[model samples]
Target chain A: MKFDDLKKLHQKKYRQQFGHFLVEGEHLVLELQRALTRGTLASGSVTLYVSERYANFASPFEKVLLNDRQMSQLSDTKSPQGIVALVPLPEAPTTIQPAGKAIYLWQVQDPGNLGTILRTLAWFGGFRCLLSPGSVDPYNPKVVRASMGAIFHVPLELDVPLAALPDRFARIGCLDLHGESVVADNFVAQDCFVFGNEAQGVPREALSAMGASAFTIAGQGAIESLNLASAVNICAYEIQRAQG
Target chain B: MKFDDLKKLHQKKYRQQFGHFLVEGEHLVLELQRALTRGTLASGSVTLYVSERYANFASPFEKVLLNDRQMSQLSDTKSPQGIVALVPLPEAPTTIQPAGKAIYLWQVQDPGNLGTILRTLAWFGGFRCLLSPGSVDPYNPKVVRASMGAIFHVPLELDVPLAALPDRFARIGCLDLHGESVVADNFVAQDCFVFGNEAQGVPREALSAMGASAFTIAGQGAIESLNLASAVNICAYEIQRAQG
Candidate 1:
């Protein structure tokens, strides 16, 4: 396709109807291409649409071709990496099945924190993530950027009502300052991990109703609690290790 | 001081000439005030400047008041919390001490990461931070925000050349992917912890010539290492635990 045609995709109108967003950068483009080639996509197929004028773009993907100006318009970055891809948003996984190894977030408001935590989950394998109704939309642009493509690998289910969580995944743990030590040997492997709000933490009513136990990641000195992103990383890693 | 006068301090020129910047918010304002009351500063010092209209801005600190407009100009935040202070810049700390425990960063570019690490250090307790030359300026606004008030509590010294570091901090452990397991039982507590750039990690020159022993924070994950902030938290916690 011509370069100018790709540039037009940046508008919200085009992005919505087409169900695709321009993802730039050679590394990410190649990764998406690999996923496509491997048939790992959750739903609609991604097309390697490119223009010949932009052929010099140094991406790892086998397929690529786009004109320079065309790819540049699709990029959100200040310095375009000379490549862009039109990727279908992965279909949200259905039949979560409460794998007895999952993460639940309650109203995690910061996009950056949400994305960072999502990336952390992808790093430490095992564990699906479910976002309660109040949580920010996972597909928000800031979350997508901070996640650094981890959203593609991690199975994140959003807009899930808290009441819908199943009982077999019963080992729900919440992080609270008053909770037990996270590092204790008694830490058990469970399916459900619930994180609360950024400022107020999980609502008291939600905590009470969930009947979830609480545990704190211990630190000796001055911090109130780890930042939400940091807390998630610590919890996710420890939980992954404990289960393994 | 009237509110109009207080508003002028947010500008870089005013901050430099006055040698003070507004550190507002309930937590930060309280922390600075506490330090002042403890006689941490010289007598007749802390100008607990706030707009007189903001007299309702309650704090334990004795107010040498300013007006609303002045407070707004001095604040970096979009909405001034109605309190601002014109405290003196802290005297540069005395000679950099390598007193058996230290945190070092080499080309750690992100201000948020630098500030967050400083906060983590404060939380872990008993450690001094040293930033290699070319690292992010310690006082960047984003760094200040992410560090919360830990920036005040943690002593961060920057501009030290990396090459000269080992001469003072002899026992330096470089955090690397290929190094020995940092979480293993055999891991020993070291006098200094060195982390490299986030993208490139520690440069080979520093790793080889400085004679810093290598250690890896164990993560069998997708990405190479934890986020810079998360890695710092884990390291600080590990150090404190090892000491205990």
Candidate 2:
């Protein structure tokens, strides 16, 4: 891809149009290669771009050599890591399988929060991320970068409507101030944990539609709420703990 | 304060020199006021600055109205929240009492990570945060902002060397890959949970000095590690869970 076209991958529109997204830094490129080796990703779906300094780095996919200026132009970060990969965007599944773990987000606006949530989900494994319409693009460079390469490992369904969650999962859980304690032995098995926007929490109507049960990570301090990602992390960990 | 001087609060040097820091946004300002009302914060230690738009907002501290431009100048965020507070930095205590919850961060470089950890610590309550010498400044504007006013709620001790931890806490727990599972029944009560830098784990010597016991949050997936803040959150939650 031309540097101009590669740079366009930084934006959501270009990523959607080209059906590809950029992954930078050596760590992520290594992760992409690992996914390919594991047959989790298609072999020819990645195109690696590297500066001359890193041109000799062993990569399984087709490689493009670029100068520092071209590499910098293609990078989303201020200090370019000299390696970028254009990976085909995996098709979002229209229907999700029931019975496994899943996380549903409604209009989560922060890329960092989305990324960290994905990382947590990937760490636990067996969890799919369902993003409601109007959520930040999962393929946004910031999200991809912050995900620490979990973007490749975790399955993501984009533009999922909150109203449709009931059809997809058996139990839907959400965090709320007046919810059941997540640590309670009576906390039901939830296939989907729905998180809301950072500012405005899960809408009441949608919660009722999904028959969502509220769960709270009870704490002693004066904080009004935990950061969205932290809440998800604690919830995911609790699920793992319960299963173990 | 002059605009130039107000702008200087963004830097750690200036904050240290002036013995004060800035808090922005309506939520944090309200939190500051709440802290004052609850007697958690000293009166007359906060100087609120507001744009004409928010001039009528009730605050316990003295308020200075500023123009939009001046408000923007005083704010650290790209979009000024039109409210700012100059808050005096609490004096770091020379010694910490043993037998309560505490978190120790060593060389944690990310301001956001430090901030989120503080927020988590505050939410758990009865927890003090101890920063080893090389960690990011808890008072950095980004840290303070990301803290969501937890900066005011959580007690912090800066520039604490790791070697001094044993003198303060009897049991120091550190997360590790090969350690005892954090969810295990044998997980002991620890006065301090030592978290390491984002990239580097805790220094070997320091961990040894603290007699830090290792604990792992077991996961099935191939993720190399969890985000530092997420790890800390999980640890804090586990501590709360064990106690409850």
Candidate 3:
């Protein structure tokens, strides 16, 4: 692929067209390599791009060394690490059935929020992240960066609709302002957990139609909302806490 | 202040120079109004700037009308709500005596993280936030926006030294990767909870010098670290959960 075409992976459309996205920085590239070794990421689907400084870094994947200008063009951040990876968009989960409950994010918009949630889900293990249509692209550089490479570990399913959740999981729970406490007895028993958009939370009628139980974090404050990612992180922790 | 001067609030220095910061959008403007009525904010220190669209909106604060361009200049968002407030920097907390335990943030850098943490602090109530000298400006526009108006309700103290914590809180606690579980019986007994910087975390030496107890959230995952705001948010929820 042309170096010029690789730079285009910064945008979602180009990433889709080229069937790959750019993962920049040494830490994330190392994570990609780890994922490759773990067999979670498909082998032979990654291409390492490094500058002169990392020309000798040992890696199994094919390496392409770029000059300073070429490295800058392929890098997303202002301070380029001079090392990046061209990772293929994760192919559909093969025979390896990823473990755990489902976390359905309903059009959650912030790339940072999605990435942070992925990190949280990855930390707890045994969970897959599902993004609703109209959500920010999970493969966006910002989301991948914010995930701290959790993007390579956690199972992700994009364009999973809010409406499809009911058929997939018999018990679904969601956060609501007036719901029962998340620590309540029934909270952790759900098969799937749904979180809403940052600005407009999940519609009441939609949640009711899906028969999803309501659970609130239970707080005492004059403010009305929590950041989308923060709410998900708390829920993930609660679910893990209850298991022990 | 001149219209030209208001534009300068976009930068942190000018915010300090003018002794005020901007809060944009209708929700936040309403939140500021709520704070004013609740006596959390001083009566005369707020000035609302509105475009013709909100010319008749009712509020006790003095209102200034701005043209579309002026409103755009004042707003940090792409879509102006045609409403913004110039709120005075909170003077050193005087006789009001903010309630509850202290949350000491040591040099938290991201505006969104600091703002989200403030929101979490406000949501849980009974917590006054303390920022170390190098932390992000709590009143920066990005912080204010991300806070979703919690900045008005949460009591904040700035430029606090981390070393001063030892003299103030007799029982101090900080999160560590290998510490006891956060859910332990004694976690709620702390007078102050210290959260570290996003990248470096609280140095072991500093934590040791302060005689702070180490508590971990405890999880099983291959990926390491949580987003700073998410960590603080989870801690706030856990503290509140234990209290009940």
User: Residues A22-120, candidate 3, lDDT per residue (tens digit)?
Assistant: 998889988887887787786677889999999998888799989999888888888889899999998766633345878889988889989999999
Those runs of model 2 whose alpha carbons end farther than 4 Å from true positions after fitting are A1-3, B1-4
Report how far off residue A238 is in candidate 2 (Å): 0.1
Estimate, for each residue in B219-239, the C-alpha lDDT of model 1 and write its tens digit.
Answer: 545543467777777767666
Ranked by DockQ, top first: 2, 3, 1
After superposition, candidate 1 runs with Cα above 4 Å error: A1-18, A34-40, A48-53, A56-73, A77-82, A98-100, A166-168, B1-19, B34-44, B60-72, B95-100, B186-188, B242-244
lDDT of 2 by residue, B34-144 (tens): 787667675576888999889899877899989988887888888998999899888765455834688888889998888888888888887888888877888888898
Give candidate 3's TM-score.
0.95
Query: Quick one: best DockQ, which candidate?
Result: 2
Which candidate has the top score in TM-score? 2
Whole-model alpha-carbon lDDT for candidate 1: 0.67
Q: How many backbone clashes does candidate 1 have?
A: 19
For model 2, how big is the iRMS in angstroms? 1.2
Residue A138 displacement (Å), model 1: 2.6
Model 3 docking grade: medium
Q: Give the TM-score of each candidate.
A: 0.84, 0.95, 0.95
TM-score of B chain for each model? 0.82, 0.94, 0.95
